[model samples]
Target: MPAVTVEDLTVLPRLARPGLGDQPRPVWQVTNAPSGYEGEGFPVRRAFAGIDLSHLDPFIMMDQMGEVNYAPGEPKGTPWHPHRGFETVTYIIDGTFDHQDSHGGGGTITNGDTQWMTAGAGILHIEAPPEWLVQKGGLFHGIQLWVNLPRDAKLEAPRYQDLRSGTVALATTYDAGALVRVIAGSVDGHQGPGSTHTPMALVHATVEPGARLELPWEVEYNALGYVLNGSGTVGADDRPVRTGQATLFGPGDYLTYAADPVQDGRAVTLDVIIVGGRPIREPIAWAGPFVMNTKDEVLTAYEDYQRGRFGHIPV
Candidate 1:
């Protein structure tokens, strides 16, 4: 396969929508609001809502939330909830999240930690503030991604992987002043931690101003780059993107990204969530927090939750 370059990536401009004026107070409060994205009781807010990147595929939704001030001793966290027919990947950049599920799975995810939860069949889980985090007010940040499961794997057993920073592989492109942290899949010949059930790639990249980097296309999957901080340009041919937005690329095997030397003079951190899989173009019967192939399946999940079939706490 040919290596993709910065020039091959297309940039799709993201239309700016009216944002809540004056950055929401206590960012966490706004995100954790009862009626926000995800659903009620998912305490850690400050999430940037994202849509399905590809037309139909293994991935469904992605949310990046962070750069928020967290007060010490605050009882802020996600309550119990159930998920089916999908997986949840949580990457923590700041603070800590204590995760527990009914499958007898539990762990504390700190900065530079990754929690990959495969909610096959069914699972009930809760992420809450650790005692230490609650007492020590500081900055808390992270990203939560939702990946759809293939039909055959939908009813498989649930699994979880906790990866520390050192385990994940990193590929650096010095010429382009860019470095990519591979969370899954191969990047620049480097493989990442956390085994993926499906063929998918998730990378976190940082590019210095005026630098350029190219990504090869061997895996046919939908790709997108989300700007976390600073501004830059991405795309190929007629496509180009600006900062503070996500640029969805077109069909191709490779794509390139370049930072504007004049505007992005310094290094800019970009959180790129690249996901693609053989499209599962199946009907989606989603209800509040449960997503299944049919409405009956959704109902079954809820019924199980009510019956405490998933259990009250981690098994």
Candidate 2:
């Protein structure tokens, strides 16, 4: 686990979306203003595609979205949808979402709130627009991440944790002018909220221009960085990376980053969800929004949702 310089890092090609029926469009590499949700009014833009990291080992996908304004009294999000075999984390950076699920979980995720939902066996849920955000006409932005459950926990009982911003801890490494907020794991001797059933670590980071930060890597896991704003170079081997992109690191024990000194007025801020576990290496039978090891399991999940197996959640 020797430390490598940034110069040796290789830049991998960005992943593209798979073909859809008849025709399909190319996928984007960086986070952009999301188009309105398909059929629904919420905005959604994918941050990663084709499943990064180990298959159902640690994390599966990441989607970042924003809504600056919504029509008055208009619905703002996806209708009830089903999910199984994974955990969903919705972190609200701004605005609010009135969320409800079939398992008797319902609440509003306000600014700086986090909703961790484990759709272990099965769950149908919907996230709707909050009246305040719709009325005030302000900016709303956040991210949704999907973490895969371990094989043993795939069929476990579902649960939810609504965490306030004050409950999470933040640590700033002054040397690099970097702020690391612990959302799921330990960072700089500080721990985050909500215990994860699987071994996972997530941190939201911000770096000032010309600053350099070093991240210690863990063995037995894959690591990647998602740039949210500004631009910089990230990698153990001095690879040149920029904002609106994800840098997948190769096998290494540590990573180093340096903000572009030339961009003196600009800074780089990003969320790094470092996740990995013993790789499942099993077949991935994914359709629509559900991912399972076998196609039969996926079909069963859809059937269960349609049959009202996931009954209405109480407010």
Off by over 4 Å in 2: 1-39, 50-56, 67-75, 174-176, 261-280, 313-315
lDDT of 2 by residue, 137-169 (tens): 655667788887766777778899887777776
CA error at residue 216 for candidate 1, angstroms: 1.8
Provide the overall lDDT of each model, using Cα atoms, as 2-decimal numbers. 0.62, 0.62
- The window of 10 residues in a row where model 2 has the poorest summed lDDT is 1-10
Model 1, residue 39: distance off in Å is 6.7
lDDT of 1 by residue, 28-100 (tens): 1101111243333333332223444235356666565544576665436777888888889988776778888
Query: What TM-score would candidate 1 get against the native?
Result: 0.78
